[model samples]
Target: MPCPPAVRPGTPQWARCRAMYTSEETAALLGFSDGGVDEVLINEAHWTMRNLLLEQLDERAQMLTGRHKSLSMVEGVQHDDVDGIAFIGYHAGAGMEGVLAHTYLANSITGVWVNDVRASEGLLNSHVVAEYGVPVVLVTGDDLACEDALGYAPGALKVAVKDHVSRYAAVCRTPTRTAADIRAAAREAAALATRHQPVRGGPFTVELEFDAEHLAMASTVVPGVRRSGERKVAYTSETMYEGIRTFKAVTTIASAAVEEQYG
Candidate 1:
């Protein structure tokens, strides 16, 4: 997940900027408050789930930082009181064209389909939160990611921080510029956080295509995952909550199966 000067962990231009992105977004949404909103929960969803720099955040907000969260990226959404959620720094699904795009396993997974739909992390997580009546209120990422969100969170405000040029390259905007755009959009997004009825959009099937054949066979060790092709595995669950869990298990298994250098 660390790509040196271009996308390394501490560089402000790459990974560190996401902390600023999330903080500014939080500040913007809360700035609109008239005592209507009280708390802001920022969850770390990036690699290791510890990428966000806590000191950069406003005092009014708290972050969920750690790994092995019960719900993973959408961990905080399980509570009935959560009205809305946002997908920030998300990219296109695996096999799609977007900056640093990949599904859960990053490389082993070449693509994922949720109930016959090509699904990004944003799309998959959106379905998971829908079970709890939390709407996706805003999404911020590269241009392709914004476009990807259109299918899963159509009404949610979208802010593209950069234009995708390739998987590792983008026509990026300065943080100063993008922050302003995100701040404004998030302020507006705060109004759309109202909760709705819980959605039971499932009896879901998840299909994953891997880059290697061995990864496919390895995934089958996870219960319910079966080989669907030479390099693909499929699983079904009654709800997206279960579906996402199974998907995580499959990816973890596939990750372990990948051979170094030759993979």
Candidate 2:
């Protein structure tokens, strides 16, 4: 209903995460709103690749993800080197009412918690960036997504490109209007990208609840992860960095264990 009651705020610091396009390094792109990314001159490659990635994940969850063969999100960027980050096209966490609501997996994971706080990708990522003093400066998505951002990035600029009607439907704005809205928000958001002291909130107890009992059992393959209940598993990480990586592992294993029609 409401953005996970009193979820602990993570990385609320301000910092600059510059999105440099082809030739112009200063030109800012507002990013995705509603179902698709707002078509921008620089968004062509990014948008296409994003769709491809999503298709791959949805089609082949068992094949593994960034944490494996290819560069993962965590390994791709130097968290310490980043000044800030942007969470564009975010949605509510799994089990919440929002567009295509799910955590890392499509439908396997029912919930994710950090320090026992029900967390969305934005919240989990905000904590990751916070470890290196990177503040989340801009978050764009549906109205609920914008509302979710308030808990994690209270200072970051928010733009709701659409109003959620159902998991698959929304009252979307014209591409023209959304682009303009995101552009203005991005401009202001850039100024909020001022880095602050790195947060060392650790000893995090990361937990995941799955739809099937076997998925929970499968997650135990990861080191230090153990079943906390009938359909839930939990792990402890000293840092959010490791926490995310482990979470990724758990999801990968659990998804790989999925049956075609049953899962």
Candidate 3:
């Protein structure tokens, strides 16, 4: 997952500027091979979901690239054999300070809460994978993102590639330094990959706060979602699988309703 420039004017800039970062991160993860790990599936979860450079990855791993995935960010976790998952190049949630931070909708979403707890994409996806009995073994990101992971996957190994100064600025480590650290951590994290009984931590409640009132109003178009406040909508589901689906639907519908100039 590449971190797009905060003020890039077009896709070309993003492609030229940010794509290499994610590739380097992906390469660092290849060190997991030393821990008796057989395969690695890189799910493209960023904007457009096609940021990772395929040729840059180690040949031993296969990547899942594109969009319209059933599980979205944690797309491959539905498999019964997946013992662990990792959050690579993730950022803090919307309303938090980290580079290119947001939930599903980059600008419209203000906050997301799961079971009355503030959640990032990591937390929400962590709950989703839990239902499938897969542990989140490692998380790599900026300092704040690693701190955020502590709330959901406390026992998982964490690597901070940068230190957040603001949403756009970060004190970054050079690729050589970060890659060495990430590879070593991934090797250690591999030993933590152990599946457990599926967690039925539901019925789950999800609440989303939007940056605009119109976005909240638009979210109600998703059947179960209703306006919970002037700029908030909430929904509940019997399981997190259902919960994430509804959340995706709500973000989709709301994004469509955004007014280009005013939003």
Best by lDDT: 3
Better of 1 and 2 by TM-score: 1
Instruction: List the candidates' TM-scores in order.
Output: 0.92, 0.75, 0.93
- Could you tell me which residue pairs clash in candidate 3? none
Give one digit per residue, the lDDT tens place, for model 1 in 65-126: 99888789999798787887877777898989998888876677889998889999999999
Per-residue alpha-carbon lDDT of model 3 for 1-263, expressed as tens digits?
A: 22445324256767674555665556456767877788788787876777677877778778898989999999888978788888888888988878767887777888999888988999999999999999999998999999999999999999998999887789999887887888888889998888999999999889999988988998898888988899999999999999999988998898888887753
Give the CA lDDT, 0 to 100, for residue 97 in model 3. Answer: 78
When superposed on Cα atoms, how far off is each prediction in RMSD? 2.3, 11.0, 2.5
Error of 2 at 122 (Å): 0.7
Candidate 2 residue-wise lDDT, 191-212, digit = tens? 6666798898998998899989
| Residue 116, candidate 2: C-alpha displacement in angstroms | 1.7
Top candidate by TM-score: 3
- Judged by whole-model lDDT over C-alpha atoms, candidate 1 comes out at 0.82
Segments in model 1 whose C-alpha atoms lie over 4 Å from true places: 1-36, 261-263
